[model samples]
Target: MIVTIDGPAGAGKSSAARSLANRLGFRFLDTGAMYRAVVFAALEQGVELTDADALEQVAAQLRIELGDQSVLVNDQDVTRAIRTQAITSATRYAADHPGIRALLVDQQRAAAAGHECVTEGRDQGSVVFPDAECKVFLTASERTRGERRYHDLIARGEQVTLEEVLEKQRERDERDTTRAVGALIQSSDAVVLNTDGMSPDEVVDRLYEIVQQRRVAK
Candidate 1:
């Protein structure tokens, strides 16, 4: 069985999905990290983010591995490297390329071939795993999301102002929703959950209940 969680950044999708997967003893796939990996590879190769052909070439030959809780590229652990500001800024550009998206989607599908996995990303439900058994779309107000991101960055020792964080968040939201390939969108059959005021545990419990109910119905 596959459960897909789609949401914008800072909406608790990653935490919720990971927790849900652990609760059910299923593997977790963080698709966003795949895009980040592509950006990281492109940067290493001196490829411009907007150069679609070059970016696609880099993505096609890229070697990315997703472990239990870590990500590796070309046998090198890049769990922390890909989270840099440089890579984060370029990720949307790389992910928007249709050629790159095609290659990465195939790899993502292959990764989940036989296992029970919970995949989370902007396009997991709408594009990567449209036929997943359970599709959930988590959402929250922009202010709330920005606050979460601001705190997260502060925790990481990144000196960033709340205004700066909010500006970046807005830019990301626009890019994600307007991108040509696999644009961020809620699946038609998805269950939308507004998480503006919900705790992580509460969100996880609700999702767990929904999954169980779906399984029982099946």
Candidate 2:
């Protein structure tokens, strides 16, 4: 079984997907981190964000490992480094490029080729894994997601204000929904869950039940 949770950034997709995978004893694939790793590497190499050809070249050569708990790029641990607000804002240069999105989609499918997996990203259901057994389009208000992101960043010892985070979150939402390739949209067959005010455990439990129901139906 492959469960796909698709939503915008700052939504609790990562937290809920990780916890749901643990509960279901399934492998977790963070597709967003794949794009983030590419972005992080691109910025590290000083590749211009507007250079799509340069970005594709970097993605094709770098080694991205998606462990159960961490992300490694070129054999270097970049799990935390890639999640910073800087990379988050600059992620679209890679994600929006058709070539880079195609390359990463290949990697994402290969990673889940023979496993029972729970994958989360902006386009998992609509593009990467359209045939997934259980597809979810998780929704959360922009403000709610911003608060979550702001608190998480503060907890990580990163100094950022709620206003800044929310502003960035809005920009991300606009870009994600309007990107040229792999844009974020709810699949026709996906179950839409508005996650505002939902606890982490509650979210996973709901997803778990949804998956179980799908398993029975399958």
Candidate 3:
């Protein structure tokens, strides 16, 4: 069985999916980290974010591995490194490239083949696993999402102003929605969940309930 959660950044898709997977005894796949891994590689290679050809080349040659809760890139443990602001900022560029999306989507599919997995990303429901047993599109008010991101960065000891974070969030939102390849969108069959006032536990509960219903129906 595959459960896919698709949403914009700061919507708690990652945390919710991880928790949901654990509760359901399924593997967890964080697809956003794959793009972040590419961004990290680009930075290391001095490849400009706007250089789609170069970025595609870098992605083709890059080796990214996702484990239980960690990520490895080029034989190095960069589980934490790829979450930096720099990689976050450049990830949109990498995700916008068709070549990179095709490659990474294949990797994601291969990783989840023959396993019960909860996968989350901007396009997981629409593109990566449209046939998933459960597909959820999570969303929240921009203000709430921005605040969540701001607090998360501060907690990580990153100096980020709320205003700056909000601005970046808006920029990312625009890019994600307008990007040509695998742009963030809610699949028609996906159950849309507004998470503005919901806790992670609440989200997981609702998702589990949905899963139970599906299982009973089957």
Q: What lDDT, from 0 to 1, does candidate 1 have?
A: 0.88
Q: Please write out the lDDT profile of model 1 over residues 106-195, one tens digit for every residue.
A: 998999999999999988988889889999999899999999888877877788899988888899999999988888899998999988
lDDT of each: 0.88, 0.91, 0.89
Best first by lDDT, ranked: 2, 3, 1
Candidate 1 weakest ten by summed lDDT: 81-90
Top lDDT: which candidate number? Answer: 2
> What is candidate 1's TM-score against the reference?
0.95
**TM value for model 2:** 0.97
- Encode model 3's per-residue lDDT on 110-140: one tens digit a residue: 9999999999999898999989888889889
Q: Using Cα atoms with residue i matched to residue i, what is each candidate's TM-score against the true structure? A: 0.95, 0.97, 0.95
Please count the clashing residue pairs in each candidate, in the order shown.
0, 0, 0
Among all windows of 10 consecutive residues in model 3, the one with the lowest summed lDDT is 209-218
Candidate 3: clashing pairs of residues: none
* Positional deviation of residue 208's Cα in model 3 after best superposition, in angstroms: 1.4
Q: Candidate 2 residues 59-114, lDDT tens each?
A: 99999998889999989999899888888888888889899999999999999999
